[model samples]
Target: MKKQSYGMKWLSVEVVVILVGLLFLAPFYFVLTNSFKGFAELLVDTSGLPKSLSWDNYARAWEVLNFPRAFLNSLLITLFSALCMVVAASMAAYRLLRHPSRINRVLFSLFVAAMVVPFQAIMIPLVQVGNWLQFLNSIPGIIFCYTGLGVSFSIFLYHGFMKSIPLEVEEAAVMDGCNPYGIFWRIVFPLLKPMTITVIVLQSLWMWNDFLLPLLVLQKPELQTIQLATNTLFGQYLKQWDLALAALVMGIVPILTFFLVLQKHVIQGITAGAVKG
Candidate 1:
């Protein structure tokens, strides 16, 4: 066998991919660069780099966004929401795979169906229900909401991953001394690390960056997450671009870092999940 020759067609495709990647990255460039500029400088030269790097905007944004509290709020909501989705989805998926009875099949179909139903369509009703249940204006309420929204897609992924796992493994565990919960926790769950990381990363990105649900539920300033807190920089009369951008940078860095660290697992998990389910 010989190496394939490089051609213009491949070069063209590579260039196109690079351009598209840059297009997507443009917003990040703008946000990061402008965050260091003054309001006047940003307005004067939207695309140009700042004449001098300034840390004042970030300092002000830190205090304005109440960085620590906001970060904590976002972190807690994301963590708990991911936890709820993972445990519920993985167990449900495992059960569905192991026993594909009529009711279970129908239940799985409903979970798939729920994935297609856009959240916007059910937003109002969900809000009303939350209000009725008195779960509004609280961190737990938002985490609860995230769980409900995220579980379907997560279950779908886990169901696929579960199918990839041989039943003989579970049987072996049963033959040894492992009970149901023991088999799941000690034997199966560890094997699900890739898919679990995928679910956590995906859900964390959603919950961490989420604005609409948090806005609707959390009205108190003290309850604000990173996105909600950063949004305070914009008003009808004035938009604090520099500070807002700085806060925005702060808001995105953690989630971006998280995705970078676990991105390989994400691809593997999604591929594994898609193999059967």
Candidate 2:
């Protein structure tokens, strides 16, 4: 009777979880169905599928949003920032682990503390510094900003994961006549694959979806990221829902495709990284 009761409880929990998942996905379902719709048909019945499949909305939105340029801009910023963030944080973490000191502990504490400090509190000072440095409205400027903001969290993750890695392997590499740089890049960095993939996935999502920072830094039309370009579709009184929904769908597809392609790696990375330090 106890075994039967436990099985019944498990089934109920699974049903509830499936229902919640469906509820969370309802918005995406609406976006997908309405993206192919005309303005008239969308207003008539948003809950239903489009009367007929159409590409007009997507084509128009693509041209207006300058999809190619926006996509390229987002891609560059995300890739550059993630690469720098991973390399710097991983190295820093490895160094702290290999040679722990009072100063190193204090610095790691500061990085962890900085993560809880709200970005809003630093926005004004950050913008002021950016202006003074003439870093406003530039790709390199925003990429720099993303790297700074992402470093703390990335370091924290790396520090924990690196602790879990046995130090004996690194010591063996040193005995084999590997230099410090060679030991880190060829031996240590490769072993950090799981955490590196985790950091890349997390940072890419933030950098790609980030709107406010890009909005502040990128004023030129040519430099606008995908989110900024999409914002242009909104007006004070009227919204181009048909075009807006189409743009949203287009925006989601690329990231969705990215996640789908790397999903196995993402899962493995997160699972492995979660193993205790």
Candidate 3:
């Protein structure tokens, strides 16, 4: 009787899980199905499958949205920003953890405090500063901004994980005549693989998907990211639902591919971090 009850409970839980997943996926189903539809058909029956597969919407979206350029731009920005944040945050966290000076402690506290401060609160001042620095609409400019904004959270993650590492590891490296930079590059960094991957994946997703920052900073059509490019498909009088949905799908595919490939590492990183502290 107990075994039967356990099996029944497991089946019930499985059914609930499947239902929840379907609930989340239903919207994507609509988008995917309607992406091949004509605008008229979409307006008439938004939920139905296409009468016939239409490749024109995807092709038109690609050309009108300048998807190739946007994809390249997003790739460059996200990769550079993620790399900068990971390298800077990892080094900073390592030194701060090893040394633990009062200044370092105060600075780390300030970073954590900054994380709690909403980005909306400082958007105006940030824009003013960006304008003053003449970084308002440039790719390099936005990359720098992403690095700064991403550092705090990355540092927080690294700092927590670094606590689990032994001080003796650094001491051993130093005894072997390793300089600070050498120790960090060779020994410390290698041990930080899991956390680093976690930071890269999370930050890459955020930087790639972000719309507001790009919209605020980049006015030039040539400088637009994928998200910004998709927004252009919408008009005051006519919304190109088919084209917009296609572009949306195009923008999502790369990130979804990335997550699928690195999903195991991501899960392990989170699990390790949670167990450590």
Q: Give the poorly placed runs of model 1, Cα more than 4 Å off.
A: 1-6
Model 3, backbone clash pairs (residues 3+ apart or across chains), number: 0
Candidate 2's residue-wise lDDT over 85-202, tens digit each?
Answer: 9988999988877788999999999999999998889888888899998878998998899999999999988887777678789889989999999999998899888789888988
lDDT for model 2 comes to 0.89
Write down the TM-score for model 3. 0.96
Pairs with steric clashes in candidate 2: none
What TM-score against the true fold does each predicted structure earn? 0.96, 0.97, 0.96
Q: Write the per-residue lDDT of candidate 3 for residues 29-62, one digit (tens) a residue.
A: 9988888988889899988778998898889999
With candidate 1 superimposed using the best TM-score fit, by how many Å does residue 249's alpha carbon deviate from the native? 0.6
What is the per-residue lDDT of model 1 for residues 1-277, given as tens digits with 9 covering 90 to 100?
Answer: 1233457667889999999999999999999999999999999999999999989999999987889999999999999999999999999998988887999999999999999998889999999999999989988998899999999999998988887888789899999989999999988999999999999999898888888999999999889999999889899999999899999998889999999999999999998888773
Q: Please report the TM-score between candidate 2 and the true structure.
A: 0.97
